[model samples]
Target: MRRLVLTSLLLAIVVIGLGAYTRLTHAGLGCPDWPTCYGLIDVPETSIQIAAAEQAFPERHVEPAKAWNEMIHRYFAGSLGLLIAVIAFVSIKLRFSKSSKVRYPIFLPLCILGIVTFQAALGMWTVTLKLMPIVVMGHLLGGFTTLCLLFLLYLRINARRINTQGEKLAESQLKKYSSYALIGITILTAQIALGGWTSSNYAAMSCVELPICQGDWLSDLSFEQSFDLIPPNQESYEFGHLAHNERVTIHVSHRFGAIITGAFLAWLAITIFLKAKTPSIKNTATILLSLLVIQISLGVSNIWFSLPLKVAVAHNLVAAGLMLSLIALTYKLRQNSEESLYE
Candidate 1:
């Protein structure tokens, strides 16, 4: 089980990295279709084959590198699916075999089983739907959420510094913090979706300042143009044309959200530092502050440098890390408080 958990985490890490790679290579629409590249399961190999496929879609040309990048992402995702399947199988095997992990109260595997299925479907839709900004963002969040949940479970099962119950102070504030964390997760996920949308549409460079978009504290952009689901030009989106106005909209929203999120975290961290006794809480707060600063710095760098691939990817990666860190902190703070009180 330990091995399985470790492998799953690694697989997820690789997939996340691959996803970024696909974005950097501009291969989100490389395959130009889902479950197949140019309508074939495996990517086309030779120019003749590529031409034959391109001939089929005379209007669309499949760049070899772009298709490969997209296909590689799918392969990694497929690999992650295999790990999840194994986890589900072992969970059932452990369930019926009278394992020691299954004591008076059994841990549930059904939730994970359900989530894996949903994630697979969502993954398919991310491509089939031609990387719809909203769906892609949802899928990205779902991926991290899966990883964090698995990590928490692994910590509990391995007894790696995770307590099943709370301390006195942990108990008194459990419910309050739980709600706060949930809210944070919700907001953070939406912000990430906006971030992904901005990147997918090539809009990260649309605005170039922090605490403002286009020189305003509040991003002033045409949401109606930018957020339109369909391309404003009435062209096929897979041809790689997205709503530029929509892209601009996403850029502005994400930038402002980061400012708001960073401000919120600064306040949240100070509050936790003052009100919570756990050193872990203090540490989480500190780490979050650092991440907030790093994220903003990267965001600015992305623009000043004209959306350099490396910095853009780093900015995306940092957002993911921040989201997970907040989730972990929320879980620890709220649950620990509850146990402290209950005990």
Candidate 2:
């Protein structure tokens, strides 16, 4: 079970990296459609082949770079799907048969499977529709949500089977900490969503100066243009688009959100340090704080250097990693309290 958990965690991390690669390389349209690349199971091989396919659908404007990026992401995603399916299936086989009480073990993974499938579909639509911001944000959120569910499943599967000899009741106060962690997770998730929105909508460069969007110290910004549902282009929907409004709109929000998330994480870290004597809980807070600092650095760098692909992708990967770390931390907290209760 420990091995399984470790494997799942590694696979999830790989998925995060691949996702970053897809965006950094601007390959969201590499495959051009979900579950398939250029209407094939795998990406096309030659320039002629790509040209022929592009000729078939000239309006969609398929580019080789984007196609490969999208296709590779899908390939990795497909691999993850197969892996999780195996995990869920084997879990069912091992933990349940005729009268096992572990009926819910399969439920969480199954839900993840279903959601990933939907997310795969959304990925296709995101490209075909020419990178709609809302859909892309939805896809990003779905991907992170999938990560959380997988971690939960991994934790549940690795739960130690202990013989309780007149176990005492667990402290209900543990639930309070769980609630606090839940709040942190919620806030972090929202920040991730905004990050995706800022990325998909090309809002990252909206405020290049940073800390102060639009080169001002807290200007009265107009989200009317900032919140445009469509992906901002070099033309159309003018007015501070890329040259002015773009950096002003996105950088500030993204930076502010990171600070908020980091602040909450800091508070959580202090709480754990003071009250959570368990090694696992304390280590979780430490990991959480470490990731928070890294994430903040990535965000600022993305702006300072003008949103390079590598930096942007690293930013996204770190966000996903941060989420995974939090999930593990949450489960570790649960494990600590459970052991204390049952001890």
Candidate 3:
């Protein structure tokens, strides 16, 4: 079960990276259909197949490269969903089995299964709705949530093995920083959502300049349209429907969100590092700090390098990494707190 969970977790990361790649490459609508590419199981490769695909979905021509990208993401995401189901089944079986001594986490696995199910729905919506910003953002957040939950499940499953070597922190110390860690997670989540919104709306490149947006962005701010969940009616939201000003508003807002999130997480990491008595706790904090820095650097590189495909994908992946590191820190703190309670 542990190995299964770990595999699912790694696959979740791959799904996210592939999703980012698909989005960055303007392949969100590559299939023009859910769970299939132009009514086919795979991309239409043959000339005849391509002709048939184009004939069926005349509005969406067959771009083999883009279609393959979307389909590949779907394939991995589907596999991860199946793996989660197996994890849930194994968890329930273990819970009911009298022969098993280990306390498997039944609820967490079940919850993960539920989330993955919804994530599948979101994935469909992402394509069917023509990359609607809200749906896309929700899908991105869903992926992050699934990743964090899987990491949490892994920590829970290995709690005994993990805590065996590390010196436990005092309950008082744990209490002091747990809330801060939780806040850090919350802030990072919001920031990630903002990033998704920016990307989904094609606003990532709106602000080319560093430190701020272009040409008196303050005067050109259009908050209402930028954050509007439901924009004016359109046949499709592909390539984004927002004006330059609106996109700039979203991009600038994401930039501000990054600054706030980075500052808060940095403070939390440093505080935890200094206050932690256990090497394990301190090491977790150190890793969190390192991820924070890497994430920030990636953010800047996205702007500096004109949002290169590799950098953009790395940005998304590192955000996941940063979130996971924070989860690790929080798990260590909470585990120590519980141990201290019993001690």
Candidate 4:
């Protein structure tokens, strides 16, 4: 079960990265259909096939490259979903078995199954609704949530092994710092949502110049339409339908959010490093700090390099890393607290 959870966790990262790549390449609507690309099991490759696909969906021409990108993401996501289902089944089996000595979490796997089902729905809506910002953002959040949950499950299943291997910390120290770690996770999650909203609305490139947006961004900033849950109806939100001002507002907000999130997480990391009684805890803090630095660098590189594809994808991946690192810290702190209670 541990091995399965780890596999699922890694695959979740791949699915997220592929999803980012697909969106960045403007391939969200490449299929123009749910689950299938151009009404076929795979992308229409042959000239005849492409012609048929284009004929059926006259509004959407066949772009083999983009269609393949979308399909590849779907394939991986489908596999991950299946793997989660298996994990849930195995968990249940283990829970009911008379010979089993270890207790496994049945509820978490079942909850993951539910989330994956909803994620599938969001995936369909992302295409059917023509890349609606809310749906896209929801899908992005769903992916992140799924990944975090799997990481949590992994930590739970390995609690004994982890606790035995690590140098113990005083319960008082960890309990005092756990709240800070929790706050750091909360801040990071909100920043990631801001990122998702910015990307979904095609605002990532709205602010070309760093430090701030274009000339007079403050005067032009308007939240009226930028954060609307229900945007006006449109045939397609392919590139983006929002005005330049709205996009600028989103981009600038994300920039500011990054600054705030970075500052808070930096403080938490430093505090943990200084207060940690064990090398394991100290190393976790060091890793968290390093990820923050890398994530910030990637954010800057996105602007400096004009949002290069690789840099943008790396940014998303690093964000996931940051999330997992914080989660690990929180889990370790709580685990130590529990152990201290028994001791």
C-alpha lDDT values of all predictions: 0.68, 0.69, 0.88, 0.91
Model 3: per-residue Cα lDDT over 1-343, one tens digit each = 7899999999999999999999999998989998989999899999999999999999987899999999999999999999999999999999889998777777888899999999999999988888889999999999999999999888888776655665564346566688788888899989999999999999989999887777888987888878999778778998899999999999989989998999999999998788778787788889889988888999999999899999999999999999999888877666653442211
Candidate numbers sorted by TM-score from highest down: 4, 3, 2, 1
- State the lDDT of candidate 1 residue by residue for 154-197, as single tens digits: 54444322454332324354346667667777777777777766
C-alpha positional error of residue 88 in candidate 2 after TM-score superposition, expressed in Å: 2.8
lDDT computed for candidate 4: 0.91
Weakest 10 consecutive residues of candidate 1 by summed lDDT: 334-343
Candidate 4 per-residue C-alpha lDDT over 1-343 given as tens digits, one digit per residue, 9 for 90 to 100 = 9899999999999999999999999999989999988889899999999999999999998999999999999999999999999999999999888998777888889999999999999999999999999999999999999999999998788776755665464346567788888988999999999999999999999998877777998987999999998999999988899999999999999999999999999998898889887777788889999999999999999998999999999999999999999998887776652452211
Question: Over all chains combined, what TM-score does candidate 1 have?
Answer: 0.81
Off by over 4 Å in 1: 39-42, 101-109, 159-178, 209-211, 215-220, 228-235, 238-246, 336-343
RMSD of each candidate relative to the true structure: 4.1, 4.3, 2.0, 1.9
What's the lDDT for residue 24 in model 1? Answer: 69
TM-score-better candidate, 2 vs 4: 4
Reference-based TM-score, model 3: 0.96
Of 1 and 3, the candidate ranking higher by lDDT:
3
Regions of model 2 farther than 4 Å from truth? 1-5, 60-62, 98-104, 161-175, 217-220, 228-247, 335-343
lDDT of 2 at 301: 90
TM-score (C-alpha) between model 4 and the true structure: 0.97
Score residue 308 of candidate 1 by CA lDDT: 81
Residue 229, candidate 4: C-alpha displacement in angstroms: 0.8
Ordered list by lDDT, greatest first = 4, 3, 2, 1
